[model samples]
Target chain A: MPGVLDLVGIFVFAVSGALAAVQKRLDVVGMVVLAEITALGGGILRDLVIGAVPPVAFTSVSYVVVPLLASALVFFWHPHFTRIMPAVMLFDAAGLGLFCVTGAIKALDYHLSPLHAVLLGVITAVGGGILRDMMSGQIPSVLYDRQLYALPALVGATVATALWQQPQLHGVFVSAGSALLAFGLRVAAMRWNWRTPRARGVGD
Target chain B: MPGVLDLVGIFVFAVSGALAAVQKRLDVVGMVVLAEITALGGGILRDLVIGAVPPVAFTSVSYVVVPLLASALVFFWHPHFTRIMPAVMLFDAAGLGLFCVTGAIKALDYHLSPLHAVLLGVITAVGGGILRDMMSGQIPSVLYDRQLYALPALVGATVATALWQQPQLHGVFVSAGSALLAFGLRVAAMRWNWRTPRARGVGD
Candidate 1:
């Protein structure tokens, strides 16, 4: 069973996905499908890459139920949700932070190298959003968005990886600190409108 | 090590993917990346779902090498390929047919039920194309294209699954027949412009 933090992360992510479906004018079925995909896609991708078969998403009933509940909530109260978009974005950052830390830890548990663990961590953080964008027929914002999204995840993953090397560190504290760093960075980036530089001479 | 037939399928799929990259005016690196993704994404998805660790695409040198060669070929000779787009489509059909059969057999090997095997088979045949279209920021053609694409893969996968239930049947012949059936259906659909009907009253 996933912890409360993980379930909260999945619920927020699922809500984001359901909102995207509504924005695209998709029907109820599409809302459910998108919500499930967004909530589970990243973890599934990480599990697949790390040779963890029967991914947790498939095996855990709570993982599936949380997404469904989120979808239902969005479906019934989406107009209210639109008014609270900022709050949703903040929650999304928390989800990203939590996913990056947990994903890295999971990869390390599977005996993957630190570098691979970090890479997988970042992937798990952003993959669901990428899938959500693509399914909606949009370019993944992470690839070209000026905002510092993936960079924050990368920083968090690196921090987790670095801390993981020290076995004596308290595991819960290490994870909490890394996730908090990522969440803080993401929130700051949004607040200050921080932007990554565009590639020179490419788009121009 | 994959057989010659599997290599051919990967090569053709890679060619199709590279051609898409060229059509979208992507760079050489993009071409290679798309080629690899299109060639190996389906099998990898199937492998991941069935608990096959470190999918063949990662484990086998041939799978990686074949797509790289195909990408290079398309990079230098794309104009010629554009002129022979019909031929490319036919080859793609062959790849679809081969992948569906092989994917189904692999699922059955992993002791998945016939229903799951059939589903995986179709996914393996179409997953790469969906990923390619998504990565390129387009709606997946298989989802909406007015052509018989995934249907043929379903037919092939169903056939393979049914035949696998009978151990006395010759493995080589059963696979060959199933693949040929799928290839023929796809060719006929293309020649006749067969299309699946859109949902009634949805778009309207």
Candidate 2:
């Protein structure tokens, strides 16, 4: 079930990446490349930092195939996608929620401290989008987006780690609750236009 | 000796990163962060890919301290440093040369294929600058620089790999020769304004 959720998250991320490529007027190859990087880059980065070489993204054919399919769908139907931007944003939030919980859990499995696990989880959730923006010659949205993206991931990771440390919590329930909490927070932030404050006296 | 060479490369890379921060007019905190990322990012990336857990950048005091020291120097003496830009470029080339050989050798130690090792080598040589560019909101120079940057690293990595495969070669001589070759190629390319051709139909 977790594996299936991961694939679904990757697909949504890939679609978003492909849309970015379209907006940038990139060619077909660029769209696919961006999609793959958006889908797999975060997991790859998390895995590498934790010494999980030959990361699951590299080993799983499904991980590769799902993103390619998502990219293709977006490439052929981006106008429809643009119209459904709200739905897409919802799915992206879900992806963030799922990734943070799973990334934190994986770090715990490697015996990392809870604090470090939380950090890794946030990185895993945001790293792909960061890479995508960088490749597109823009500042990373996570760094500059007024929306509370990384904060939600941090909260989700913290909750997940806390639950995991409990002596009697059911794993499935813990994961689901943490992910839903993050998803809810992200959705609320978007709906309410929750914005982080910029530094004082800093001119853009 | 190789350890010392790696530190030297890191220090130079960190200085370049700090210089970039100055150009961008980033604050001191940003300067230090950029410098650390530039000096250690490539090696951390290389170590992660090769399953070297707790990367040397995280483990070694020197690796952390050198970049901090470099950042401080750049922050205080940037005007003088900028005036000697040509010499700095030469040093950057030498750093590139050293890193490519060392990175490839490390990858080879992990028993990666020679081809994979060479690729890692080039990545290690250029990855820090790429990160610095991306953080500064520019396209990675490796992707767009006209004056043949990655190519020289490629040549150096390939030479080092091939020589390492030879049964009768001395390790020290092979490393020195490969580094010199890469350094010389980079210098020549800059002197002659050698450029990799852009796609004919691609508009800048």
Candidate 3:
């Protein structure tokens, strides 16, 4: 079910956040806080914009528990965890894909414009990571000129949203296809060193 | 009216955010985004947690426009704005006082516990600045061990929430008095260089 996939996504994001904490040398409390934020921040932002009260992350104990568990795991064995960074990034890409489709659907359900819904989907995919980076005192990776993160999310969300408007397409199929597209694109971008052009004379 | 005062507070916060953007050498778009976030981030967080739908920041045109205007003003003449930084900080403290009381009252109205209401109050006062700092790639001033920013907000919010629970006190008086107390405390802290104790052996 979509709910189960969402949890999986949350878990992956939480692990990434915990790793970021390890890198920053933050306290145990900081690790847990960062994990929670990285897992739930985007969903919370999406729900708030679309008027979903007591956001799913807030209302569901399972959502809170999963991220905390991820944090605890990383806290106890971060060295081992860091060794699996490549695997984590792949899962993070899947989460990004799933969130974009789901977030777009949710926004449309709330009667937002197609453009707005797409934007919200991208936000739901990238907002958490942005918050995580900012909390760790770094410029968000999404803002980096060389990062191709948000673009793929935007593409996947657009595809899903468009598919959603087609009467013949099943909802689950639409979501699955969108997720796969985004995940594959992200993986490709990583493998190929895809980069965005920086503003002229901006930085080295 | 309280609404008018809230706008003033927002304007001051937006100016501060714009100044931060100027320092960061962000483009006009960045300045506008930071301004909007800094002015409205706290209220948006408070509203989302309290289940206030379609946060006022998203709904109101003035809320959006005021910050954009502030960003424009600062983008063009940052030198003048920077010279008035002290005056802006004083107003920012007052705004913090007002927001803490208002945010607490709103949370209580939504049936949150006193403790949660007070926490929301402090968040509403400081969350914007924290977001602004993070967006600009800096550790939040609130997280600094020696900063006394949030404590005064906590105190004011607690006072307001307690007064709200009492049937005898006039609501307007309670709000005004709470704001005054917080404003006085913040001003005094600034004047005296009041410091909070850091964890032993933490970085200086």
Candidate 4:
């Protein structure tokens, strides 16, 4: 069940990635690469740190196929889909929540500390977006004054860790609840235009 | 003494990186970014994996100053330089040798096993180039038919390991000689156009 949801997270993240590529006006190849990384990047980092086998890129056909399809959609249908950013943003938030919970669970399975698992979960949620921004020549929005992006993942992972502490509580409720926490926080942040304050030490 | 050599290695590698950017007709900022990554990339990877705090990027002004100077060279005077490709190749090889040897020593200092140290050394040598290629949408040359690039690092690291097996043979000779072996083999491979053979099963 977790694995299936993880795939869904990857698929929607890829669609968001293709949307970013379209916004940036990249070539088809760049669009595919961006989408792949956005979908699989966090998972890959989590795997490498845990010394997992083959990497998801080689281990799962869905990982590749889903991103390719997403890329194709954005490339061929951008004219019709440009106004769908709101829907894409919503799905992206859901994907972030899904990846954060899954990544934390995976880290715990590897016998990492709860703290480390939470960190990994947060990385799994935000690392791909960071990488995407870096590749596309933008300051990672995570570093910008954007809304509470990474914070949502951190909060979600923390809740997941609390669930993990109770052996009986480790079920669909924890996953669903944690994901909702993240998605709701992010949507609120966006709607309210919440942002982190900048360091005032430097001048323009 | 070795630190000085590493600094020189950074300078040369930065030159190569800046030249690569120039060849691709990128602007100044791109040249600087590529140059900085080429110069400090291997060490950065090494530090990160070792759980070393304040990765070289965070602490060293030399790492910053040298790459900027290299980029300036390419930006201001590349038009006057001829046979840029060979210069880039030679410096790249030199940087590879320096990184391979230094990385092995660092791994040993961290008390890793011989095989593990050697693996780290190889990663330190080629990992940056692999990343740079990925960002630029190019297949890594090392993954292709290119001759024994990583193999040289393995051999050098192995030699250092053997030296460690006997306490009597220590100090500069063991380290420098191992480094020499790596450099010589890599240069020979480059000069001879050596390559891994392709095709498998029934030959086409």
The sequence of per-residue lDDT tens digits that candidate 3 reaches over residues A77-153 is 89987788899989999999999989988987886766667767888998898889888888776654354678789
- TM-score of predicted chain B versus true chain B for each candidate: 0.97, 0.96, 0.96, 0.90
Order of candidates by lDDT, top first?
1, 2, 3, 4
Q: Model 3, A86: alpha-carbon shift in Å? A: 17
What lDDT score is found at residue B19 in candidate 3? Answer: 81
The C-alpha TM-scores of every prediction are 0.61, 0.63, 0.63, 0.57
Instruction: Candidate 3: give the clashing pairs.
Output: none
**Which stretches in model 1 have alpha-carbon errors above 4 Å?**
A1-43, A49-51, A56-130, A139-204
- Per-residue lDDT tens digits for candidate 1, residues A1-204, read 239999999999999998887777665555665787798899989998887766777566678789889987887788888899999999999999999999999999999999999999999999998988888898888998889999999999999999999899738889989999999999999999998887786662
Report the poorest 10 consecutive residues by lDDT, candidate 4 chain A. Answer: A195-204
Of the two candidates 1 and 4, the one with more favorable DockQ, higher being better, is 1
Q: On lDDT, who's better, 3 or 4? A: 3
User: Which candidate, 2 or 4, has the higher lDDT?
Assistant: 2
Q: By DockQ, highest first, what's the ranking? A: 3, 2, 1, 4
**Model 1 / residue A71 / CA error / Å:** 14
Q: List per-prediction Cα lDDT, in the order shown.
A: 0.87, 0.86, 0.85, 0.75
Chain A TM-score for candidate 1 is: 0.97
Per-residue accuracy of model 2 over B11-122 as CA lDDT, tens digit each: 9999998888777766555566578778888888898889788577645668878988998788677887889989989989999999898899899989999999999999
TM-score, candidate 3, first chain = 0.96
Q: Where does the lowest 10-residue lDDT sum fall in candidate 2 chain B?
A: B24-33
